[model samples]
Target: MKKIFFAFIVTLGIFEVHAQKEFQGMAVYESKTSTADMKNQMGKNKEITPEMQKLIEERMKGMFEKIFVLHFDRSSSVYKEEEKLDAMGGQGQGGMRMMSSMMGGGGTFYKNVKDKMYSVDKEFMGKEFLIQDSLPQLQWKMESETKQIGGYTCYKATASKPVNMSDFRNFRPKDQSKEAGKEEKKETEKKTNFMDDFELPKEILITAWYAPEIPINQGPENYWGLPGLILEVSDGKTVILCSKVVMNTKEKATIKAPKTGKTVTQKEYDEIVMKKMEELREMGNGPGGFRGMRMGR
Candidate 1:
């Protein structure tokens, strides 16, 4: 009886050690936006022929489809795009690179749920910015819906997120009422500003599917605050889905937040981007630029 008791105590100690081990995981996600709407919108334009539309579609395809990897521990995670070479063996096309900057791609995002803060290393128009901000408080409404993704059972949760009007992904064709058409004609007569017609919805609904078995509150991009790890997210136009998940890899990921670049809050970062875009527009309109280029014609 004494020998059996000693063995039981040793077994319990080993189990405790295993239980205390830090949990780590890596998730690969494939993000893609539906181009059908964009194509349909562009098809209405008389200037864009079928061949030109196809070329634009191909370019936009590269901009919309991206792969991201999330390396996460129990309390923190780092998410970044998986770099890939372009067709011509260079980094990417100039147009694609510009689209990436406009879409805020190619950034290292770090989130610490325990500390209730997040940081991002973003480069825009040749300027690097470190955006440090508090985690957004999403009032998620849990649903009874369930689905299987990559062999894991995921539950649905949803919330409303404020839309950024400047994001091209959120752009929708505005309904042209008779009164609005008259106003638009008047503005056109006055040579309306190129940026005046761009519009996006005020708010967007976010749907996320989280896997409770993972038990981490981390997610791709700026999404979080769920009871489990978010495996998939959709914001109407774009969908990010987990393609693979590996648990407890041999090498633990370094989950340090980015420290370089000009530090600014998220709001300030948005303001800076908008201001720069405005400046560029002014420069383009000034001298020997793409002066006739306009949106919402």
Candidate 2:
């Protein structure tokens, strides 16, 4: 069995280069999180209710939605869903509304915000790192510790940023009068910080593991660039793994970069977007109450 496993890994190392290569493997990681409710802002004196806890749990579950085993070679991407999402408006208001409806509004908005607000990628040092295009910042660091998963080795990395639970609040627009509605809409338009509340790995940990023999940057989601193939990844509370790995299959694996958008370096695009977001936030204040949802924030 050990020899069979060894041969399987060796086969994967050689032929998984073609985009079509069917390299089978599993990736894993842990997920931990905290949730806050704006409605509960009434304060600590109020007893915590089971209903609220359920809501929080449901929200947390959604926040950890990407936990799963991913299968792909150099040619495909673990975040194929996101690739498809790019066709849906590039994370703008339209994207948020679509996501909120699919996730079931309320708690869903907060969770979805965190998921799309930022992008996490594996770094040149083989460590998982986070990019806050919203904040236009990038940093990499080692995670908490290592673990053995499904006969593979793994390492952990964490970031020291701040997490804003306030993002959990629902920002839909609310207007009582017809004139008020139009006035409010025009005033709040373009002032929403829909992306600010939903960044992942704010003061969180991430783990990534690669096969020492692969010597290529690759992993699930946006993670890549390790000495070997990454088998598992996680933030302190959420985990995702590659469950089955088939190395060096009959077909070849080919990888390609995304062709959409105004092709710019990640850093350059982030800076421009971050500056734009800040300008929007400063220009106007969005609705104050649970306003009705708008197409763009």
Candidate 3:
């Protein structure tokens, strides 16, 4: 029995190698984020009632649940959101647009494992940016646990990623004391602006599941470097799961980098976004401006 099991493993390895030589596939992933934490944070505000909270959750559900497609070959992949019509007839169009910009959505992400590089075509505040950067190096800890996704056997891997300060999903409301001295409150208000009401954690844990049968080291979004093709990923707040996979389709997908924006590196892009947010805060905090407005309110 031991020899048979070893032989089976060897045979699977051989098949995986052969598949990798000519594998080309498209995978559909359904992504959804849990807004429970955000809601709880916002619940601190006395202005929000139970009905208001429910309404907010409903709107956020529509904004956070999304579909994405990953077009991948052996060494490269292109991941992007699958566009869909708004069910509310564009009622919350502006909110959706803002959420997309804040979450880094509606972009073309191209990754080249062979070159250890990635390129993203991102549009923020009506400006296009081509962000080119080296792929992030993650120290993945592989686990002995196994599961099945879309009929493929998968293994578990986990890694820690630094939280991006600019990502609004990572924001948490600041704790303020209502009983502070008037002088202290005035000093705090003078030193800080609306943007200071939120803070981001230092890091987030990323859990992924990869299927060795796929024989490609690719994944949804910026995750990769596993022994196989990643089929699902969870970062505590959001969960991305593979719903369907089409292997070796008749129409091959074009896996090329985008080139139609102001070129910048990842760091530069983040700085640009931060600068823009600061500008908005200044504009909104001026006389008769959009002040005293909390996020997600």
Between candidates 1 and 3, the one scoring higher on TM-score is: 1
lDDT by residue (tens digit), candidate 2, 1-297: 999999999888776554334553333333223233323331221233555435434433443343333334443433322111332254244434323322222111000122323233312112222333332122446554667756656665443434332222222212335345465664655423323223333354445655655544456544554556677655433355555565554553233223222333446534543454445446543212212223223
| Cα RMSD of predicted structure 3 | 7.6
Q: Give model 2's TM-score versus the native structure.
A: 0.42
Q: What lDDT does the true structure give each of the candidates? A: 0.75, 0.39, 0.76
**Model 2 Cα shift for residue 292 (angstroms):** 8.0
Q: Which prediction has more favorable TM-score, 2 or 3?
A: 3
Residue-level error in angstroms, candidate 3, position 231: 0.8
Better of 1 and 2 by TM-score: 1
lDDT of 2: 0.39
Model 3, 1-297: lDDT tens per residue? Answer: 999999999999999988875668999999887766566644654445677667656665755888999999889999989888776676646545655756646778999999999998877766788989999888999999999898999999999998765566666545556334454665544432333445676788999999989888889988899989899999887889999999997787888899989999888988887787777667654101123222244
Rank by TM-score, descending?
A: 1, 3, 2
Error of 3 at 292 (Å): 12
For residues 1-297, write the lDDT of model 1, one tens digit per residue: 999999999999998767545668899999888777666655654445787667555655666888999999877889988887775455344435545645536778899888999998877656778989898889999999999999999999999998653356776546657347477565456432323433577788999999999888889987999888899999988899999999887787787899989999888987886676678666754101223222111
Q: Per-prediction TM-score, please?
A: 0.81, 0.42, 0.78
| Winner of 1 and 3 under lDDT | 3
Measured by lDDT, the strongest candidate is 3
